[model samples]
Target: MINTHTNAQDLSSWQQKYPGVSEITTDYSEHYQISINKNNQLVITQDNYEESMIITDKGTGFSAVESIVFSDLFRIKSYEAYTLNNVNGRQKKTEVAHIADKKLDRQSVFDSDVKLKTFNFANLTTGSKKVLKYEMEFIDPFLLHRFMFATSAVNEKRTLKISYPETVKIDYKLFNIDKNNLEIQTETKKGITTITFQKQNPVVVKQDSEAAGIMYEAPHLHFWISEYQTKNQTHPVLGSIDKLYAYYHTFISKINQTENQELKNFTLDLIKDCKTNEEKVKTIFKWVQKNIKYVAFESGYEGFIPREAALVYERKFGDCKDMASIITEMAKYANVPNVNFTWIGTRELPYTYQQLPAPAIDNHMIATYINNNELIYLDATNATVPFGLPSSFIQGKEALIAQGNSYIISLVPEVKSNLNTIHDKIELSLIDKKIVGKGTFDANGLAAAQYRSIIGDNLLKRKDFAFALLEKGNNKFKLIDFKEIDFDNSEKPYSIDYNFELDNYLVNSGNETYLNLTLDKPYQNDSFEPTRSQTFDHEFLQKKSYQVVLEIPSGHSVTYLPESTTFSNDLLAYQFSYSQENSKVYLNYDVEVKQTLIKPKQFALWNESLKKLKENYLETIIIKQHEKN
Candidate 1:
C-alpha cells in the first residue's frame, strides 16, 4: 500500500542529518507483480533506493531526478580502472550536496545556486549477486554534467514477464518555468505509454544498446514511480512569474553587453578586409570555427549566455552556447547580416518536432540568419566539418529561434534514409597458384558514413580496412588505389568508392576461397547481461555487387563454381548468386530489411536471418588439380 494524499509538509523530514556517514549500501529487485488485469492494467514493483539527487524547482513545480549507482559506467571505468568486463576500485571519499531552485536552464551546473556538502561510499563491491546494495548521495544540482543519469543494472538476460496493454495515454502540463529560454513540463500517464512510441516493427530498438557504451548515442534518462487515488482530484497550478521575469532580464542583459563592445569594434575593423558581403560572411564563419573549442563548464549562471565574446576570444575556449554567441556578435560587428541562435537534437532520439512539444526536441547548438530570409546552422565545435553541414546527429529536427518577446519554431533539413549498397570488383593474376587482384569498392547511406568516419585521414589504412572486411582468409594482401566519396558534404548521398589489390587467396593446386561481409560493428555477437526482457529486433537492408574476373593459368579448365542461394523469412530476405562466363566469375548479393523494428516474439526469426547471412558469406569454390603444361 502507498500513501497518495501526502503533501510536501506532511512528508518525512529530519534535516537528512548523518553523524559519521562514511558508507552506505542498497539492494533493489523488481518483479512483475501483475500483467493485464481485469481492468486492462499492467503493474511492476521495484524495491530500489539509495542516496539520489531530486530537483524541486518552484519556477516550474516539477522535479527532475538522477540516481548514481556503484556499478555505473563512469565509476567503473574512471575510478576502478576497469576495462570492459574487468573490474577494479580505489579508496576515496564520497560527497553529497543538494539544491532546491528554479527549473533547469542549462545541461551543466557551472554557475548554479545550489547547496553543497560531502558524504562517503568507500565500501563497495564488484562481484555479481542476485541482491546487491550500493550507496548514493546528493550532489550540488548544478554539478550534474549529462542530460540524464540512469542505472546500468540491465543486460540482455533480464526478464520482462508483463502482458501488453491495449492502449496508452499521456497528459502533460506546465510543471515548472525559467522564463522563455528554459521550462520544464510535468508529463504523467497511466497504462503503457512506451508501447505507443513503438515503430512499425519495434525491432530497431534492439539494434543499439541503451546500456552504457556503443555508437549512435542517446542521453541519460530518469523515470519515477506512480501512486494514484481511487478517484481523480484537481491540482492547483504553480507559477513564479515575477522571479522568472527578473532572472531573464538580468541574464539576457549581461550576455548582450559583454559581447556588444567587441562586435562594434570588430565590425568597424572588418570593413577594410572584405570587399564583398559573401567573402565577409565566409571569413567570419572560418574565424569562429578555427578559434573556438567547445568545452562546457556550467556551474551556475555561466550556463545562460557565455561570459562575453571578448572573454571567449581571449580564452580560446567555450561551450556550444559561447561559440554561438561569439559568431552572432561578430556578424553584427561586420555589418554582414542578421544571425539567430536556435536549438536542435541529433537523430539518436527520433521525435517529430511538429508532433512533440518544444522541450522534448533539442538540447544544443544555434543557427545563423541571412537577411531574415536564409538560415544557416552552425556548430563551431565540429571544426573539421564543412560549413552548411551539421554532423548527422542534428539533421531533421526542430529548432527554436528567438523572436522579440516570443520564440518561433523552424524545421531543420530532413535526413535521407536509404538501403546500404557495397560493391567490390577485384582482378587478380595467379603466380605459383597465388591469387592477386586490384579491387574497387563502393558504399552509400548511413552505412557509408559509419565506414568513412572509421577510415579517418589515412589512405593505406582505408585499403587495409577493406581487406579486413574479408575477415577469414588465408592470404597476404597489398592494396593499390582507394578512392572514397565525400563524407562531410550533407548535400551528397553518403558514398565510398575505393580500389585495392589482394594476393594469396588460392592453394597450391587450384582451390579458391571466398569471403562474406555481414553485420559488423554494432551487431557483432558481443556478450552483455540485459536488464530489460523486452529486447528490440532490427532489420538491415543491404545489397552487394562483387565482380571477380580471373584468368586461368596456362592450360587449365574450370572445375567448380559456387551455387547461387536466396533466403526469405517473415522479417527479412536475402539473395546470393555467382556466375562463370568465359574465365570470369561474377557474384551478386542483395538483402532487404523489409521491416524497421521488431518485438521480442520475433527475435528468433531475426537471429536466424543473421546467421544465414554469415554462413552465405563463408561459402567458397574449388578447382580440381590440373596437369602442368
Candidate 2:
C-alpha cells in the first residue's frame, strides 16, 4: 500500500506552509446530487461527505473530532468514523464512535433548527489518520451554501463534485482562486459537462484579530441552480437579480392580506397627537421597536417567509422578517406613504445582489419608506438605533426595496466619521507623584452606541463600565466620581463627566520627570500582519478628538516637549501636537478613520504608521527641577 503520510522532510515543509497548524485534511471530498422534487422545487437529493485528517506534529496526538452541522433543510442519514493507526509503518483501523449529537445552543441570538453531529478519534499518534463519512438528504433546498476549499487548516487535496440532470442549468463562480497557479482540470464524461477546480496544498491564512470574514479571502465556489427546465417550459429561479427579487416577493405576497382591528386601533390612538407625517411614522416605528421583542426564529420555510402582521402583533415578538412586516403595516396605517419591506445584507456579508443574486447574498430584512427620491431604512430589530440613522452594521450595504410587484436596489448611505464621534476635554494636575484629572467625554451616533452596549441595563455596574471606558495609565487608574447625561435618549449625544486619578504614572528619575499625555490610544496595539494576505475591515468609521491641558508643577522648568506629528493615508489620519505656554502644557490629538478596509498592499504603510505612533507614545514631556517646591 502507498504511504499517505508526509515524509520527515516534507513534514517541516508543510508546517512552514501552514503556520499555527498541527493537523490538516489530507483528502476531503463533497459529492452532491440534485434533482427536481414533487413540488417542482430544485432541491439537493443527496450529499455525501468524506474526510481524512492526519497529524503533522508528533508531539500532539491526533484526536481530531469531526463536526457535522446541519439545519432543518437537511436530514442526516448515515455517519461513520474510524481511527487508522500507523503501526510499524502499517495502517490499522481502531475504534469507531459517534460522540455527540445535539441541537446547537442558541442563546439570545435566535431559536434555530440547526443541529450538530460529531465523531472523534480517542488518541492516535503522529502519522495516524482519522476518517469520517456522512450523508445528508435535503428536505427543501433554496440556496446552495458555498464550498470553501481553504479551511482553518491546510487542505492537501479537497474536491467538490456535483451531479445533476442536464435539464437543470446551474451556475458557479470562483472566488480568490488563482486557476493558473493551481492544477485545474476539466473533463466532460457521458455528454455531461465536467468542470474541475483542483488546487494543490491550499493553505489557509493564519488568523488575525478583527480580520474580515473568510468569504472575502477563502478560495471557494458559490454554486446555485439558476433555473431549471421542464419538457415544455423553462422556469427562472435566480438567474438574474430580477428573477431573485421575483422569487423573494412570492414569500411576502400573501402576508398581511387582512388587517387586524386591534393593530389599527392601537396605531391610530398612538399617533393621535402627532400632526405631521414624519412625526406619526416615527412614533409608530418607535412603538414597534420598544414593545415587540426581536428573536431570530429560523426553521425550514419559516426562515424565509414572514408571519402575518396581525399574528406578529399578537405574539409581540418576531424575527427580522416579521418585525419588518408589522413596522410596514403600522407605518402605512399611520399615514406614512410608500412604506415597504426591504431586504439587505449586513457588512459581514460583503457581496452585492448583482454579484450573486442568490438568497445567500442577503441575511437580513428591514422596512424602508420612500418618497420621490428619498429612502429611509427602518431596522426595528435594533431597539436603540436612531430614527434617521441606519444601524451601523447595515450601513453602506445594498438594499432591495419592495415596490408593488417589482423592486429597486439602492445603497444605504454610510455615516461619516464626524457623525459618529468622540470628543474629550480634560484638565490634569500633578500632585505627590500622582496625576489627577477631571474631564467630560462626549459621544454621538454609533460611538455612543458602543458605550451603551457595554453599559447595558445594570445600574449597579455602570460605574465600573465607565471607568473601563476612560481607563488609562496602566491598571493603576482610578475613577473618583462620574455622572451621565442624555444616555437614555437615542436621538441625542451622551456625555460623561468624570474625575480620575492615576497613581505613580509619572516617571521620576532624580530631577527629570517624564509623562505621556495621550489617553485612549485607539488601535495602538492593532496592525495587519506583514505577511497577511487578507484585508482588515473596521466595523464603522470613527473620529476621536482629545484635548488635555496639564498644569506644570510650581518651580519646575520645561526641559523638553515632543514636537507635532501627523500622518494621513487613504484609510486613516492622525494628528498629535504638544505645546507649553507658561506653566500649562497642552496636547491636541485627533484621529479620523476614513475607510473600513486596509488592503494587503497597504500593510507595510499601515505597520509603519503604527510603529511611528508607538514611538511617539514613548516620547514624553521632560521636566527639570529648577527649584524645590
Candidate 3:
C-alpha cells in the first residue's frame, strides 16, 4: 500500500516549487445540459466541480468558506464539500457539516432578487485539499450562459462542457482567448451536440490592475440561445443587435408616459423665468440635479423598467432610470424640444453594442439635449456635474439616443487636460528657520466644479481641506491664513488666496543655506509596476502650473542654480525653469497629462518620465551670505 506520508510530502514539494502561489486549483469543471420538453419549455441542468489545494496561508483559508450566488432565474439542486487530509497513516475524508442560506439584499443599496448559499468545510489547513460539488437548474432560457477559465488563484486544469439538442441553435463567442492556451472540441451524436473547452496551467490574472474590462483580460465564453426549431416551424430569440434593441425597447415602452398635471406645472414654474431655450433646458436640468436623490432599485423587472415620471417626481428620490425618466419628461413639459432619452455604459465596460449586441453592454441611462447640432449629455445621478458637461464616468463612451421609432449612436467627447487647469502663484521670504509664503490658487472647468463640491457646507473645515490640497514640502508646513474668493459663484473660476509657512525646510551650514526648491511634487512616485500586464486608466486628464517667487534676504547671494529641464511624450509633458533676477529667484513649473489611458507598452516610457521628474525634485538652490567690506 502507498504511504499517505509520501503523498503529502509530494504535494508539499510541488507547493514549495511555486512559492508565490498561495493556492492551486486542482480541478474545475462546469457541465451544462440543455433540452426542450414536449411543452417547448427549455430546461437547463448544470453540474459544477471545484477542487483546490491550500499551499500557503495567504489566500488558501478563504476558499474553505464557499459561497454560491444564484438569482430567481436559477434553482439549486444539490451542494456539498469534502475535505481530504493526511491523518496518521492514511488519508481521511470529512464532509461539510453545516450549510447556510441567506438573501443577498445588502450587496448593494438597490433591492435585488439574488441569494447566496454558503457552506464551510471542516479542518481546513495548509496542505489540505477541498472539493466543492453543486448542481443547479436554469428557470429561464434567456438567462444565457457565461464561463471564465482564469481566476484569482493559479488554475492547473479547467474544463467547460455544453451539451444541447440539435433542435436548439446556440451561438457562442470567445473573448481574450488568444492570449491563453485553451483547447476547444466539438462532437455530435444522435441529434445531440456537445462542446468542450479546456485549459491547463493557466496564469493567474489580477483583475484590479487591468485597464480594460474583465472581458478583455480573462478567457471567457458567452453563449446565447439564438433560435429553436420545432416540428415544422422555427422561433427566434435574441441573435442580433436589432433583436436585442427590440427587446430593450419593449422595457422602455412600458414606462408610463401619462403626463401628470402637477409635474408639468412644477416643471413650467421652474423654467418660467428663463429667457432662451438653452436657459430653459439648463434650468430644468439643474432643478432635477438639485432635487432628485439617486437610490438604485434593481430587483427583477424593476431593474429593467423605469418608474413613472410623476411617481418619481413625487418620491423625491429615484435610481438612474427614474431620474432619466423624470428629466426627459420634465424637459418636454418645459418646451425643450431637442431633448431625448440616452443609454450609455460607464468606463468600467469596454463593450460596444455593435460588437457585443447584448444588454450587458450598457448599464446607465441619461438625457441628451441637442443644440446647434451639438449634444449635451445630462446625468442627474451626479449632482455635482455642471449643466452642459457629461458625467466623468461616461466620457469617451458611446451613447444610444431614442429618436422616434429609431435610435442614434454617437460618441461622447472626451474633456481635454487644458480644460481642467490648476494655476498657482506664490511669493515668499525665508525668516529665521521657516519659509513664509502667500499665494493664489486658481481652478477652472472641472477642477473648479470639483473644488466647489468638496468645499460645500463645510466652511468651518475649509482650512483643513485647503491645507490638505495645497500643503507642500513636509508635515511641518502649516496654513497660516486664507481667503476664498468667488468660490460661491459657479460661473467664475474658483480662487483661494492662502498664506502658509514651512518649518525645517532650509538646511544651513555656517553662512551657506541649501533649499530644495521643488514644491508640490504631485507625481513623485507615479511609476507603473514592471510586472503589470494591463493598461492603466487615469480617468480624467489634468494640467497644473505653478510659479514661485522667492525673495533674497538682505545680504544673501545666489551661488548655484540647477539647469532647466523639459520632458514631453504622448502620455505626459513637463517643463521646469528657474531664474534669479533683482534679489528674487523665480521658479516656473508646468505639467500636462495628455491622455487618460496609458497602454501597457508605454509603461517603460512613463517610468522614464517619472524618473526624470523625481530627479528634478531633488535639485537644490544654494544661497551664500555676502561678506562685509
Stretches of model 1 off by over 4 angstroms after superposition: 1-150, 153-287, 330-338, 346-362, 368-376, 410-414, 417-425, 440-554, 557-582, 588-609, 621-629
List the pairs of residues colliding in candidate 3: none
lDDT of 3 by residue, 96-152 (tens): 867888877773356777788888888987777777888989875666567887876
Alpha-carbon lDDT of model 3: 0.80
Clashes of 1: 41
Q: What is the alpha-carbon lDDT of model 2 when measured against the actual structure?
A: 0.79
Q: Estimate each model's TM-score.
A: 0.52, 0.90, 0.90
Order of candidate numbers by lDDT, starting with the best: 3, 2, 1
RMSD of 3: 3.4
Tell me how far candidate 1 lies from the true structure as C-alpha RMSD in angstroms: 14.8
Which residue runs does candidate 2 get wrong by more than 4 Å?
1-22, 36-43, 56-61, 85-95, 121-127, 181-191, 509-513, 553-562, 579-583, 622-629
lDDT of 3 at 457: 72
Comparing 1 and 2 on lDDT, the stronger one: 2
Error of 3 at 560 (Å): 4.0
- Report the poorest 10 consecutive residues by lDDT, candidate 2: 53-62
